[model samples]
Target: MTWPKKYGGQERSFLDRYVVTEEFRVANAPVRAHFTADRQSGPVLLKYAADEIKKDVLPRITRGECCFCIGMSEPNSGSDLFAASTKATKTDEGWRVNGTKLWTSNAHHADYMIGLFRTSPSTEENHRHGLTNFLVDITLPGISISPVHNMAGLHEFNEVVFDDCLVPNNHVLGEINGAWKQATSELAYERSGPERFLETFYILTEMVRTLGTEPDNRSAEGIGRLVAQAHTLRRMSVSVNGMLQAGMEPVLEGAIVKDMGTVWEQALPRKARDLTAFTDIGNRTNFDRLLRYAIHIAPKLTIQGGTTEVLRSIIARGLGLR
Candidate 1:
């Protein structure tokens, strides 16, 4: 809803989009299908893509007919994006990309990927150089996606291999070998959002319902604490969104939100399990099932988007603590 009217959006405020996103999370909507496009890809294009590319892709994204995935992590790169070895050599035709991207979510169903590739060698003074962002059409030849199932046995992750994949020059986003600027700025949008913390919100709601009204002291205390933490996170996230709306990048604030939010969501299942241990909610099969699923998926929360270690480093640097 934040795009211009000519781009099929209502030209609404970022706050409007924020409310809709939170409601979708609360309702457990299956928004993953087009979430990356709406949240990150569309904005990236609006800021960096050529007018022709934006005209062609933004409308499709707005129509919910396109899916986009991020291609950043590699086989051994982990959270250090500069260590990525994905090679994208300029060719007569365009650019020939060759490398593997690991832990890419929604890759199997994505129509495009905003991929990071090495276009030159990093100099002695700047290791962040040589990396560039490219808009890749997933349907291009030599692009292969292999499923990487999580502990929950869900196929939300994949390993994408680009074997001599050809991308036109027009597909480049922003300056060549200057993606570091774009990448850092992009994190504010990527890291601070409702989805970062609401992945396991269903379990919280189910726990509350299972506890029923007039729950015991222990249950009441636990519920209150969790709700209070969630409320604080929402307030922080809202403030960050306001910054984004004002064309300001809250990189430090965004990293803090993701780090704290992911940690909380990851621990939620175990806390809920502990809270419900002595309760008679064993008869609540739905709660039992959800708790089990949440536990299975909790371990990956802090690893996605960015790892806890990486986020802490960002936070420390932002605070001049490191």
Candidate 2:
């Protein structure tokens, strides 16, 4: 995937595009390495990774020099992100962060972390107002990252421990305790993409292969239904991207994309399991490995970007819920 050339630095949505179909699935590569950089870190950095940070870190993201991980989840807080407990204190040299962060996917290999921290103590009226975003170096002193294996049988996720680690004031993103405002835009980038709905696309192709021009009613009907749902998700995702490019935060639409994408992603595996009924069906079809992997890993997709339950709350709020 060559970096699309920037047209006046407004390339988030460059209109017409042609990406490889499911044929690219069999060539599955370890995207976890660049997951944070491309997915989360890039958007945030375009705003905050200034000067030296941009020169030193941005270019290396493509060459695999700077790996990144999200720091929103915590030992005490997962879906309820306002419940985060990690703290960053002002120090003479910089800010010193402390506390443990849970469900920090791929932190072990991350060069930098876009972590959430408490810049100011939370108050009754300021519960979600004290959190801030920081770009912390995992290599900084007093910082440690440990792997947390996911049920998908992958070691990409990790737990990051911050024990008095130093992060210069330059690392602070947005304003102090103004993370919620930053998140409205940050999440637009996070939620407005095709990756969420298309992770299991490999197996979707595999099902097509197994059917081989002729299929049963169950398979035929299911495939058509899945295709229509996926197409709808893609259009919604593209619309959100258009909103993003227009310099507006499509919060409600973003929540919808994530919620629908995750739901459809979760369905891919159950459908695959039905199509494939063997522990080891290598000899039975060309898609056995792909199907097996999808069946095991599909469930994690919903929870990875955000859990189904958590995202639904956002959707409900979008619908005017308190």
Candidate 3:
């Protein structure tokens, strides 16, 4: 997929291609459209960065030469996003980053990483201050990446260690330590994507297949509910994308979609657990394995980018909070 020059481009989104149920389009189509460039790490490079980064990153993605990953979370930090311990110190050479990042998807294969770190200490509340972002190279000498075996025993994630890694002065994103503002924008991008909820969607497609010629009430009802839910969530997701395109931060709505969509993905297996025997161990528990995958991965959906609790905090504040 060629990367878009501007995130919220005037051209129709990439997701316009899929023939999804109309409802899904309303809830989350934009997310599906910008899953890669718009949703993940693309924005920081686009918004806070200079033109050179864009020039290199854009065509590289179009040519399939660039891969991306999130660099947040560690053994101890999960829900307390602001509590991350990774430190990036300013040095004459640039910034020397040293710390470990956990559950980093695509870490093993990605060419660049958008890392979260403490550039200084908080001046305001502990939540505010000292945080920053950097576009780091995985091939740098001080970096080490190892895969983390998952539920299906799949090597999809990795543990990334940065040992005094060097990031040139230009690599610093936004201000010296003003990432909190930047993070608000980045989280909106991360939380609004389709990947959060579509990881195990193949099961639903399989259910439609297993029903064969005519699905009974249970099968039809089950599939219909999922299809409808996917539609609704998708529409909401698309709206978020539209908002992002407008250069507005739809953080609260994005949280709502991720929290709700992930819940629905988790529910898919439970709703179909008894509808089919294909869930046998040999079949990867079509339900059991997917259920396992969704469950294990589900927590990360909320935790990744930002925690569900943190999202609620944001939402609650929107309702009325100090």
Tell me, by lDDT, which candidate is best: 1
Give the higher-TM-score candidate: 1 or 2: 1
Ten contiguous residues minimizing lDDT sum, candidate 2: 1-10
For residues 1-322, write the lDDT of model 1, one tens digit per residue.
9898888888999888989999998887899889999988898899999999989999999998999999989998978889889999999999999999999999999999999999999889999999999999999999999999987889998999999999999999999999998887789888999888888999899999888887999999999999999999989999999999899989999999999999999999999999888878447888999899989989989998899999999999998998
Which pairs clash (backbone N, Cα, C closer than 3 Å) in model 2? none
Tell me how far the alpha carbon of residue 9 in candidate 2 is from the true structure, in angstroms, after superposition: 8.2
Q: Which of candidates 1 and 2 is the stronger one according to lDDT?
A: 1
* Backbone clashes in model 1, listed as residue pairs: none
Native-to-model Cα distance after best TM-score fit, residue 167 in candidate 1, in Å: 0.6
Give the clash count for model 1: 0
Sort the predicted structures by TM-score, highest score first: 1, 2, 3
RMSD over all Cα atoms, model 1: 1.2
- In the order shown, the candidates' Cα RMSDs to the true structure are 1.2, 3.3, 4.9
Worst window of 10 by summed lDDT in candidate 1: 277-286
- Model 2: per-residue Cα lDDT at residue 290: 69
All candidates in order of lDDT, best leading? 1, 2, 3
Per-residue C-alpha lDDT of model 2 across residues 196-301, encoded as one tens digit per residue: 6877876776676666566667777877887888788878887887776677888878888988887888788687667545334235455776677787887677
